[model samples]
Target: MARIAVIGAGMGAMAAAARLAVAGHRVVVYERGETYGGAVRRFERDGFSFDTGPGLLTLPAVYRDLFVKTGKQPLEECVDLVQVDPSSRHVFPDGTEVALPNASRAGVVQALEAALGAGVGDRWGDFLVRAREAWDRTRRPLLEEPLWTDWQVLAEREPYPAVPHKRLLRTRRAGTLAEIAAWELRDPRLTALLDSHALAYGLDPRDVPASAAVLPYMEHAFGTWYVRGGIRELARAVYERCVARRVEFVFGAEVTRIVEKDGWAAGLELADGTVTEADHVVAGVDPGRLRGLTKHALDEDGDVFPDASAPSPGRFTVLLALRGAREAEAAHRTVVHTPDRGAELNWVSGEGPGPVRPTVTVLRPDDPALRPDEEHESVVLTATARPKGDWAADGSSKPFVEMMVHEAGAAIPGLRERILWQETRTPGHNGDETGAFCGGMPAPSLAGGKGYFLRPSNSTRLPGLYRVGGWSHPGGGLPHAGMSGALVAGLIVEGPGFRGSQ
Candidate 1:
């Protein structure tokens, strides 16, 4: 059995450990934190609990596959996975509201037409048709398999089949997502709906390629899910699965260095000067921290290098302990569109001040486990924001918190009056929880950005070193990170020629 050292007990790292252990490898994971789950954390106060990380799960098949590969118990047997009906309710700036059905194209189209206008549903339906084309073309390379060596092809090719538009004498096809919104959707509400999907993942709709249509397409195709207790329950199930597989975990043991021997990743050096040698190492860290842990070059020329110091988008969250019970028919998730799109976009991009009325996503799950009783409710509000030190430390978060509460009022009745208590978490809290650079969230890798959107390969320049996480090849999001673990395990177990999970 090979001795493998996995860094960080994040979901990805644990995912890899479980697979490697099941494959007969002696896997040891070193984490600096007191517990597992990385960003998938929970906060509780006064008998109320809240999920501080991702509120919903998309593409749960990824975890289902992980459970099947690593253990006898299926994922469904581990967690109470509930499909969130009317997947989401969107409140447009023009006072229009629409609740889209979960994973049903016909239902979504019908709802859009009913709320937006007569033919607006047809426009969105048409967009989904083209988005599905993009998903089909890139899903295998981007999700089901390891990233290709010639990843530049993914960067150069536009998988989204854009509709041709004639502007006077010149005919052009949409390129960026903003262009798709303007040229094809042709409605401000439709544009806002499209932008919200990208924004939720910390990607800028104006900057992302038109292929990002796959964002909404993913939700529509796979359906949004909620665990009974919280998303952290999913993490607990995975961590328990790892333990059951006999994978060793060393919590509170910070890995200070990636020890190298004969130019290969030999093992790990902890904060206490203890060294554990292994046959291989899997780093589940952001690029910046990975670079700091070793002196060796981890990537080759032309590989995607994410600047750790560069300002990346982070999430501002407000956990509300409300005094009243949740309405019986309330939509689980509601997105309140920003009043000023330009101001909100500029704020997240770090080009302008914070929006007076930022776009806020309000999550009010019906699960009683999060509240003290049926009379009390737990609500979570999140918005994309700049992950800068000053924003967190300069006392600016208070106003932003107020802004979020004000906007969430559109979704929740008497939001401010009903709040019994509130806790605000900034990028600072995220950095503490996940150890991500500046606490910035990483968006999923996309095609057609000159390979700029693609993350580095799982196998590093170092022979025995590999990366597995949101910052690595195939990129971020729960499903993609889980897939990274599979790819890394495949490469280590089956040699460099290993393609990916079948």
Candidate 2:
């Protein structure tokens, strides 16, 4: 059996550890923090709890496969995975509200039409049909398998089939998401709805390729989910699975460097001046930090290296401890669209001070585990923001936090008066939890933008070294991170010929 050393106790790392252990490898995980789960953290105060990371789960089949491969106990047995009906309720800037049902195309179409006018639903439904084509075309190479050697093929070609349009004697097709919204949807509210999907992932819809249609398609196809307690419980389940598989975990053992011997990834060096050798090393870390941990160039010439020039966007969140009970019919998730899309996009692009009102997402789960009693409620308000925002300063993020509460007032009844307490989190806090640069969240790798959006390959230039996490192949988000683990494990257990789960 090969001795495997994993860096970090993040979900991706633990997923890989469990699979490798079941494959008869002696796996040891070294995490810098005192606990596992990386960004999947929880905050509690006065008997209230809040998930500081992702609030919902999409594409849960990824985790289901993880549990199925690792042990006899499936994912459902470990955690209460509930489907969120009306996947989300959107409140547009123009005061139009629509609650889209989860994984129901016909229902979503009917609801959109009812709320957005006569023909709006058909346009959205048609767009989704096209989006499904994009998903089917890229799902295998992008998510289920390791990033291909000729990944540029996936990058250079746009998988999203854009409708042809004649403009000023030129017959062209929508290339960017902005073009799709303008040309196809042709409604301002529709544009806002389309942009919100990209914004949710901290992506700029204006520049992201048309292939990004897959994002919404994935959600519509698989449905959105919520763990019974919080997303933290999902992390707990994965960690437990790792332990059940006999994976050794060393918490608070910060890895200083990736030890190299004879041009291969030999092992890990801890911060305490101690070293442990392994036959293989799997690094589940940010690309920027990984580069610093190794002297050897992790990516060779012509490899897709993680982009460092443009900083990924981060999230600003406010946890609200409210005095009243949550309304019975309240949507589990609500997105309040920004009035000014251009200004919000400009702020996210780091070109401006930020919009007076940004798009806000408010999550209010009905679970009693999050509240102090039947009379109280716990709510979380979040917005995508610049990664380097000076949130550490006293009241630096107060204006934005207050704006979020103001916007959420549109969704929640008596929102401003219901607050009993509040706790805010910045990208700086995310950086502290996940060691990600600027606590910025990485978007899933896309198949267009001339390969600019693709992440680095799992197998680095260094032999016996692999990367597994949101920062690597398949890119970010919960499902992608889990898929990255499966890919890495397949590569290690089945050799370089591993094409991914068949």
Candidate 3:
């Protein structure tokens, strides 16, 4: 049995603990934050709860399967998950609105055509086919492979040259997401709608590879989903599973230095000066955070390490708890776009000031939630990347927050009618909350030109150490991070698996 320690208590970290404990390893998780679910967590702000991280769930089976493997029933955990109908509401600049259905490809396309005009449906179909092919071919191998070595070591030796899925990242990469959309639609309106991945990947859609166009296709194909209470409930469920298996969680404990003994990893040093010895260490923190905190752990060659930080193409956010609400019939699952907008203004940081504009995305409070009637609601809005220089001081400034709220209010009618509670978050705040240096979600933008393998793998710079979470292979998102945890566990269960396991 391996004595394992995970460095964060986020979704990825929780998933790692659940898998490792089930595998019979002695696992301990260290979380610098007071609560778990680092990014996707919730807090009671004025008697109302808000989902801070990813607002919804898609491809939920990825989550169910993890619990099933641990012999636990998912429903037993908090938050019952229900399939959503009419997946989301997508609006265009022309004021045309379309409601996408859940699990119906034809319906979504029909909606798209109605909103964006004709021919767009056919183009969506093409992207869907490609996305299906990518998913079918990609799932089995990498999801099932145990990537346990230090990636930085591999980089030092020449970037461990093995492609995980059959599809090649280099060869399959194609036109930019924006350019691909432009090829299909007429008005730049539709193109802008499709080009929004700029923030998703921390890239400019013009530069992001076309292969990423698969994301929308995947959404249309698989359908959008959510847990009964909130997305963070999933984290709570995973935490429960880990507890059942006796995984030790080191909450509010930060790892300061990694102890390397003669090449292989021996243990780690916590911020409090306590030393813990372990046969293995699976890093669930962002690779940047790990690298920054454990500087002493690097090998001479600097094999497994995080890529340098880069700016995500967009970001701006506002959340509100509605005291007086509406039924919100127009919004079902995902609310793609709304009326509000703030074209890049200036971003002013310590050096003083700079310019950056960001695209904004607003999610209406799902109507069927805990509201006794239609009047109470919860809402969150997120925008594409904006340079840090835009907001004076931090995002906490009343002026900055007010500006964001005003912009959101303008975008969605009646937004100001019932603001029970509210708050705003900036890219800088995100960088501080989670160690995501780029201030994007988990994955970096492929359009920005960072090498594909440049993302750290499950391996560490020193031997016997591995990494997992949004920073590693398979990229970020709930499903991807969970898969990373499983991959890490499987590697420890049996060193990188036997030949036949592949």
What local lDDT score does residue 415 receive in model 3, on the 0 to 100 scale? 70
Report the lDDT tens digits of candidate 2 across residue range 1-502: 9999999888888888999999999999999999999888999999999999999999999999999999999999999999999899999988899999999999999999999899999999999999999999999999989888888899889988857556655555677899899889999888988898888778899899999999888888899999999999999999999999999999989899999999999999999999999999999998888888997877767765447545688988899999988889999999999989999998887877654699999999999999989999999999998768456565658788888889999999998888898999988898888888888898898988888788888998899999999998898899999999999999999999999887
RMSD of each: 1.3, 1.5, 5.9
* Number of the top-ranking candidate, with lDDT as the measure: 2
lDDT at position 348, candidate 2: 83
TM-score of 1: 0.98
TM-scores of the candidates in the order shown? 0.98, 0.98, 0.83
Local lDDT at 180 for model 3: 57
Model 1 score (lDDT) = 0.89
Tens-place lDDT digits, model 3, residues 1-502: 8888778877767777887788788888877777777677664564566676777776676677778778557643545786676666655545566676887878867877877778876667555666566555434533445432433222222111111234443423334565555544445555655665444445445544554555666567777777766787788888878888898776778788777777777788888999999888777766556777554554335343334454443345677777765454646433344232223312221222423233445666464543445667777777554444345455444555555465555346677767766777666666666766645565521211233433555665577888777777556777777777777776677675521133
List the candidate 2 regions with Cα displacement exceeding 4 Å: 166-171
Winner by TM-score between candidate 3 and candidate 1:
1
The local lDDT score (0 to 100) that residue 231 gets in candidate 1 is 97
Query: TM-score order of candidates, best first?
Result: 1, 2, 3
